[model samples]
Target: MDYSHVRGVDPAVADALEGEVDRQQNTLAMIASENHVSEAVMQAQGSALTNKYAEGYPGERYYAGCEFANDVELLAIDRAKELWGAEHVNVQPHSGTQANMGVYLAMLDPGDKILSLELSHGGHLSHGHPANFTGKTYDVEQYEVDPETGYIDYETLAEQAEAFDPDIVVSGYSAYPRAVDWERIQDVAESVDAYHLADIAHITGLVAAGVHPSPVGVADFVTGSTHKTIRAGRGGIIMCGEEHAKAIDNAVFPGAQGGPLMHNVAGKAVGFNEALQPEFTEYAERTVANARALADTFSQHGLEVVSGGTDNHLVLVDLRPSHPDTTGKDVEEALEEAGIVLNANTVPGETRSAFNPSGIRAGTPALTTRGFDEEATREVGELIVRIVDDYDDQETIDAVAEDVQALCDAHPLYD
Candidate 1:
């Protein structure tokens, strides 16, 4: 994708667009929720399907001129079903949060109770942060990971579910590193006679690649982002049993969303087709391997690695024990200056404000997408530790910045 046409029409907007492309080409993207999609997926996302207004599902539309739109959506849905092994799949949602919203609308009435993990403990806002509709519309209670181990306290969660007796129990997380025990969580939800909705927004690709335990069959509803680890175009997906298919489709169409982004649906189809290839499994495996290498590097350097290590594509590093005075924000800014882009994250049993949390979260999905292996990831990890160890050291920052550029060049995204 060339933005030359855009540059001819609108220079300023084209400049920013090209700058973003250059940024990705030149920098290391370690953000856990991000990945680099193929140029095929990009082309599809930027296709003419964006002009269509497909207001309903395939074979049934509320508008005319949707024959090709129907084909695109059906293809996306069919590929998604194969990818996640769901009896039913909805590919219409504009984002992961909307996918969750679709499930919520289908299953729970307003004012019903919701039990989910705390955001500070690695949960997402859609899982019931007070600011999101999940908290405001429903009665929300939170479960937490064990302070010492940085793992979910399943027994406590079960006990709390029995006590709170929520209508739905939400598992999965935004920053969790360890593999989730979906069956265990489902047992808790079953004991409380509650529905289990596992939000795998961060690990869609891992689940599809068989690199992580899937929640599709274990939970009553499984929601995910199409983009994160899935490397699909930016959208949301829901997987559920055949019994709930109608309700979910209705909830997504009439209840929550209007017209689906057909262009994004095309991208999802292309990406899912790519995922079904054998190389995608290799990519997923390499992603997890890189994360392990990153965790080992951080742990060896005396940083507190939450849950000790990772079984997935991300690692959480608590800065407290290693550098008690430094905040995650400080390291985030320093690393960004050095062109190693990731995010500050809140740790389990967090003592500081969420804005300036005590931890940094790193992931290897994007790096792995750029063809980085465990060895290359370890080098990146070593560079991160050095910067976090001395965030203000300009000489060290400059050196790391140069190295980051070299790594980016080595694994050129656009090329």
Candidate 2:
């Protein structure tokens, strides 16, 4: 059962896998949409179903011998529906971006207008980034938060929606610290007769746990990754209201992608079942608690967190004041040397480019799942502050690596 051990694979790939596992166990993972899956989820993903070529949806496969695959897909769909109260669930999209694409393909025509959050303001690239297919194919109108408050301005969003009269209004984010107002988005979309798509990929687990409001009941379509806070296999799912159910399913199968990964679907089923447990609600609460703990630490160190602080699992640290001369990229590399994993992000309408940004983003969902509580988050935050402050010194970086290892060792993964 020691699947984490990497003793008998191709040396190059094995070495890389082992190295990744070692890095994970030694460092702290704070990426907002990332987490370590349970051993059971992992096992399910790597199961024999991967070898089977079950093209198309469950029973109506292009190929034969898909009886078991049908059961797996049904389980994933049923469990996800039960957990999130979705009328229809599609467990076929390979990733969140793909899931969103499926929804777009199902509902909109080419050149149709899509109103979404600006990418720099915590929105995903798939939403409307110029270089992405969505931007190239559809007319994009983006909205952002108030520059001073660092929160979405519903009035501005409504104005933009009216001006654009978009076919779809996207409501979601990747790096935003607070909860989005789904009702406001729904109202705006309704006023314009646009479909409301809630990309609740980051906070899906919280929504399922009732810690955050579920957009399933209000939004026309909802897309989420099963792996992030849900702690499932690496895949995406799209949930929607009853009216769009059949269209969404057909779009995912015959339109966008051909086959569903049955094994990953099985893993998703397990993850959804786990989320349905009472303990998952407790875990979600701890995730928020840990985020707050880290946010306090960042504030103590004089780093400005966007929206004052986080209302969820991720916190966006504005390192502008902390290191006026340094960039977010510089701080990110320095922190990586100290065995802390995070991403550099851009504030809304930021002057910096994507390669090197002005902000650092971290989260608590992964660490909290590893059994890290408020005290541990504080320690990790202290490490982050120390690394950022002493980034210029090689000796300090080395010392912090030792500290990171010590903390990681204290909570060894899967041991």
Candidate 3:
């Protein structure tokens, strides 16, 4: 974690950088939206390409001296197209929100209706949270998962679409743990003459690896984060049919953002190329397997695993059923003290406020990236149950902390 050059220039910032590395190395990162990228990706993200300013697409850049930048961007675009089979790909959006913004910019006008899943029901802010620009800019309505089944009620969603008569119907999700029926969502969109935007931000790698069903062909617009399960750089990507290529491209650049992050694009190119390999398929599969193991372990420990289980790389645990007295925040804080990191999330039919929700969301991507298999992930889940069951006990916390350290030691990271 030496930052000699940065140390001389700004010691304060350099110290925080080293601390962050140490933190990632020592802790269990179960955050669903995060994954550990490879050394090659880190190197590419830290390259000199950051100094370049490529404002436009490959052949029609507004700036001069973009030969290498063009090469990296073109490679990323090609790899993305091959990975997802989208007719057109845009690798320029700085984040997933911007990616959604691009789609909205291309296909919608102010006050146009947007029907999407509700935030508390596992949708993202970009899908039209009141705090976000989308909610304010567009007339928004939201759908939800079936409280009984913990899955999207496609029939109800379709009915809502008919009533709303939206311009766009948004699919995919942020905290959802099951497979999406893209065909079902597309049918709803078609029946109402609405474009569908599927946000595969969390399951990008799973979809690319053919583990989860992809919405690329079914939805009119598909958006994803470059990192998460895919191991790409921290950025965003948009994919659509050739019919809307220019609209998407122009919307992403001039409509949503300025110059692209060329260094991140280079890193994305490297990561996408890595995903194209056969090993990534194994990694993707193991990620879901580990999550299933974790969910099984938690359920065996008497915690209510949401949806009865998970078919993806994450599990949402609603604490209200088992630990009726405990909030998700209680378990989350206690787990962090014992070196198991995850987030407290809002569950479907949430009774509590967003700040401290009723459920906790845990993921296996980062742990799987650190070489954890089903057994290891199951062990981690057991450790979580211990902390959640005895959060106030210092001895329990310390004992669990030791076990967490052993796991981190057994499968070291950033070495």
Q: How many clashing residue pairs, candidate 3? A: 0
Model 2 regions lying over 4 Å from their true place: 1-9
Q: Give the C-alpha miss distance for residue 57 in model 2, angstroms.
A: 2.5
Question: For each candidate, what is the lDDT?
Answer: 0.94, 0.88, 0.94
Worst 10 residues of 1 by lDDT: 406-415
Global lDDT for candidate 2?
0.88
Comparing 2 and 3 on TM-score, the stronger one: 3
Order the candidates by lDDT, highest first.
Answer: 3, 1, 2
Off by over 4 Å in 3: none
Backbone clash pairs for candidate 3 read: none
For candidate 2, the TM-score is 0.97
RMSD for all candidates, in order, please: 0.7, 1.5, 0.8
For 88-142, candidate 2 gives per-residue lDDT tens digits of: 8899898999999999999999999999988888899999999999999999989
Where is the poorest 10-residue window by lDDT in model 3?
322-331
